[model samples]
Target: MKASDQTLPLQNGETLDILFRSHPRARRLKLRYDSVRRAAVVTLPPGVSEKSGLDFARRNSDWLQEQQKAFAGQEFLSPDNFISFLGHDHLILHQPDDAGRVRREDGRIIVGGPAGGFEVRLLNWLKKQARIRLEQAVEEKTGLLGVTCHKIRIGDPGSRWGSCSSRKTLSFSWRLIMTPATVFDYVVAHEVAHLREMNHSPAFWREVDRLVDHATISRRWLRQHGPQLMALQICGKSPAD
Candidate 1:
């Protein structure tokens, strides 16, 4: 283990992975679940004691267990299985050919490539689709909000669906393309609103509301279903696999 890392046992008999990270701007001990690494992280300010961080994590053990259980059952992406895209199920079908491309046809995503390279081809196609669609959505929302962004980029961040930087650049998770259209729109509107109000203040929400009327509903949906989206692995390796 690293110097900043340790393990604790949970009441449920599961090992709780803990990391003590120092944050330059952190004001207090913050414990959060890292879904990608499947660990609970405790971020502390420079002057905070390790005992304080451990106590904080212990206090939140129940919440951590619940989150771990939720993530343990996350759905994995695999070939020949159906996945939700734009609020509809799209069957994944693999076809062997020299051409390596993915296309949607009649409720199915047809992937053409050698069997060994199918995952890489499909992931590339998904990222490309995400970039094209998200860029378009950003353009439309920014136009409606009367704000201009420096640029838009796609990413696979662990804890956020989208973010807007102080430089006016916007970055979004490519996985948003797999969710419902309204959810994607809500995320885009959220970042676009950040262009005007960088914080989650009433004024920022007002801008989001102006762009999308169902912002609250979208937020709730993401909170409830977003984890399953994040759990999808392009390697086609499910927990059972």
Candidate 2:
């Protein structure tokens, strides 16, 4: 079946994939499911046909569903929500000041009112710190796992805690900062194992297990409270911040 022959109509709970062709700038594809819009988005590289794109989605159906479930449980942060940083609970504050800082003075991340808003700016700062901390942790743990990574970056990713690309770049969600240190370490180890083995094979599990003695607890924490962390608004930043 060729891509030009037919266009597939997406049904409820059914997945539809698309491929868009354009300029030769880069080989890239982006995935997002618009629940309100009621469709899955697949932005492909230039010169790609719709059929090949659909086939790609078919090939990755299981992965796509896993991503969708991850998205479903995510909670976007609101202003009234309280966020715990370091040790104390700070009500998300929205203020106007020359500087945006997420700091502890008298044991609270004072927001707005000369401090700053509690959303985008604060999230950006947290992402910056989380990347530094996570990359350090990844380097230390991967040494034990006996693997090297090309690069590491932290992002406001919606689907998963972390992902390892074929090129060896390790991308992690900045939301990991909300969790305890142990949980963060486990995620770092999990991604590093991908360097040794791309698939979730037994060898991969063994590598992760070797680095983090208690992996299941961290995994469970994300399964249960991960969405809650997603819902937190710090420094008036968006969830992706």
Candidate 3:
């Protein structure tokens, strides 16, 4: 059976929706803000009571509200909005004559498609660019590290920029294409380094440093600005959510 959902009253006099869930391996109650639904989710351990979960959420209500406020300013992708593409601001242009083609010119991303499908088309184009660029970076880094990868894939995972499985397949968030080139290379290098040292030990970081210069700065940049990149709504859906 599913757990019941509840509501918590915020200090602002607004009530936020809270969903209670039971997790078998959860050691304690955990609360997280769901940016997409703009709700709170409380996870209870297998034997924990819903009352306990609600109490935990109530204790963290202030924190949850802050997170909601932080995400309130997320930008939605649209024809009228400008996006940071490859570290540059690009105006979104819709050209009917170029309906299926996606290109960049004059500091703008020109899309040829029906107005209704512009966001989707632009998203698809960004994904293509991400795959192309990330794959190239992966190939170079893997070659330098004397490692081989099985394949490269692009995704929009909520919690991570990139991941490398034991199968040697590397996966990355297509949103990386929206960040600066250095940031993009840092993520690629970080994942490729995993091929050598699967864990984030000193040796793994050493490999990443060898692959990309100013990696620490790149990491800090991501830590500060990644949310902005994730906040870019694609096809009316926020990437981080």
Candidate 4:
């Protein structure tokens, strides 16, 4: 049965979730086995019956088994895992000594100057600096584009370096702080372009080009180097961890 046709209590080992959209269309049944959570979620249309969803999962049992196998041997680090930032590889020093400097050496953030709590202190300072630089880039380019943005926020995002929401808010990944100045400008320009053109249309590209001529180069840099920034293995994991 289609996921949209049932409404009943879920059985053991099954969790229910429904994603509703204003643009109603064909109902889909997604049985995702989350290895990290160690459970299976049967996502169906709202007001759907649990018996049919369970049956659907049973029918796809082989596929789910394959997925679990794929998740095997995946490495998940704890908060204390060592990470390499910029180009420097270092341990996550939680015990602050208060005798270190936040330096940009080669490509890593060096936090061991005179400070004892180097990791926490360095992360805090870097986040602040990143916010400042991102806000400046956004302001400078948004003016050029003649578009007013809602608000600028900085956080660690797993997937994208930056995102433009329908609410007109622009959020940037904190990892951008590790990249060169050019990549930072490109991301800001890209998000600002969304203000004028909400969608990724030709007009949006035109606006981005006007602000940053080498937008494509910066984009390529993200696709290549962005993942490395995320690899800089400091502890304190995000939700995805």
For each candidate, the alpha-carbon lDDT, in order, equals: 0.82, 0.64, 0.81, 0.61
Give per-residue CA lDDT, model 4, range 1-241, as digits (tens): 2223322223334333322222122256556554334345566565665665677776766555544444443332222444443324444433334355555444334465543344455667667778888888888888887778889888765546788877889998776766777888888888899888876679889988999888988888775655446544334333221
Model 1 regions more than 4 Å off: 1-3, 6-9, 20-31, 42-59, 237-241
Q: For residues 119-194, what per-residue lDDT tens digits would candidate 3 score against the true structure?
A: 7778888888988898788889899999999989888875368989889999898989889999999999999999
Which candidate tops lDDT? Answer: 1
lDDT minimum window of 10 residues, candidate 1: 232-241
Q: Supply candidate 1's per-residue lDDT for 103.
A: 96
- Total clashes for model 2: 15
TM-score top scorer = 1
Candidate ordering by lDDT (highest first):
1, 3, 2, 4
How far residue 77's Cα lies from its native spot in candidate 3, in Å, is 1.4
Report residue 156 deviation for candidate 1 (angstroms).
1.1
RMSD, every candidate, angstroms? 3.7, 7.0, 4.5, 8.0
Q: Evaluate model 2: give its TM-score.
A: 0.63
**What is the alpha-carbon lDDT for the whole of candidate 1?**
0.82
